[model samples]
Target: MPVIVVEVMPKPELLDPQGKAVAGALHRLGISDISGVRIGKRFEVTVDEVTDAVLAEVTKLADDMFSNSVIEDVVSISVHPAPASA
Candidate 1:
């Protein structure tokens, strides 16, 4: 099987409240070395095969289903082989 990884993040112009909260917490915990933080989303989709059509579909899904177009952007989409069992 193949796995597709999708990354989504809020638009640069928008304010990310969750990320701000995390950054505030980190600063409170004495993590001042890190100036800023922006949290995003990662989605791993398992599929039977990897093909052009599949990739296109995944891209479409990433833009339409996985993220909100008004506020979020689909940052990246990558393909990887599934890990072998131990």
Candidate 2:
């Protein structure tokens, strides 16, 4: 099977409270090298095949269903082949 991966992230101009809290925790733990953090979403959908139509539909789903249009943007969509059996 093929897997379609969709990645979404909050718009750069917006604030991410979850990510901010994580950064604060990191700072408290003495991990000072990192300056910021932004949380995002990743969706993996197993599919029978990959085609133009399928890609188009997935893109629509990403925009309309998987993410909030007002605050998030669909950053990437990629297809990966299934892993080989051991």
Candidate 3:
């Protein structure tokens, strides 16, 4: 099986309270390298194989179910080969 990785995140213009809170805490802890943080969600969907048609379908699914087209954006959709069988 192949796995499809879907990532959804708030639009850059959208307010991310959780990410801001985490970033503030990190800054208070002296983690200064991080300037900003945006919270997001990831999903791993397993499929029988990776093909163009399958990818197209997955895109549709991502647009329909995985992401909120109004407030969030679909960050990425990538296919990974399943782990080798022992």
Candidate 4:
């Protein structure tokens, strides 16, 4: 099995209201030292086989079908192979 990790975030030019809200809440909770807060999402996928080609395909799919390029950015796509039996 291979694991795929997808990280999605808003573009730097776009404003993230949800992120701002979370940051404000964190500040109210006495964590005021943090700044430049931005929110993002992560997705993990498990497949039988995942190669560079597969990652490219999936990235294209996500960019075209799932992510909105105007507001969202695909940060990274990482693939890790399963451990072999001893």
User: Model 2: per-residue lDDT, tens digit, 1-86?
Assistant: 88999999999899999999999999999998999999999999888889999999999999999999899999999999777771
Error of 3 at 4 (Å): 0.7
**Which residue pairs of candidate 1 clash?**
none
The TM-score that candidate 1 achieves is 0.92
CA error at residue 71 for candidate 4, angstroms = 1.0
Each prediction's TM-score versus the true structure? 0.92, 0.93, 0.89, 0.83
Give a tens-digit lDDT track for model 3, residues 42-71.
999999989999999999999999998999
What is the C-alpha local distance difference test score of each model? Answer: 0.93, 0.94, 0.93, 0.82
Error of 1 at 18 (Å): 0.5
Task: lDDT winner between 1 and 4, please give it.
Answer: 1
Estimate, for each residue in 1-86, the C-alpha lDDT of model 1 and write its tens digit: 78999999999899999999999999999998998889999999988889999999999999989999999999999999866871
Please, what are the lDDT tens digits per residue for candidate 4 over residues 3-33?
8888889997889998899989998999968
Which one is best on TM-score? 2
Off-target runs (Cα >4 Å) in candidate 1 are 84-86
Error of 2 at 67 (Å): 1.1
Query: In terms of lDDT, which candidate is strongest?
Result: 2
Give me the runs in candidate 3 sitting further than 4 Å from their true place. none
Would you give me the overall lDDT of model 1?
A: 0.93
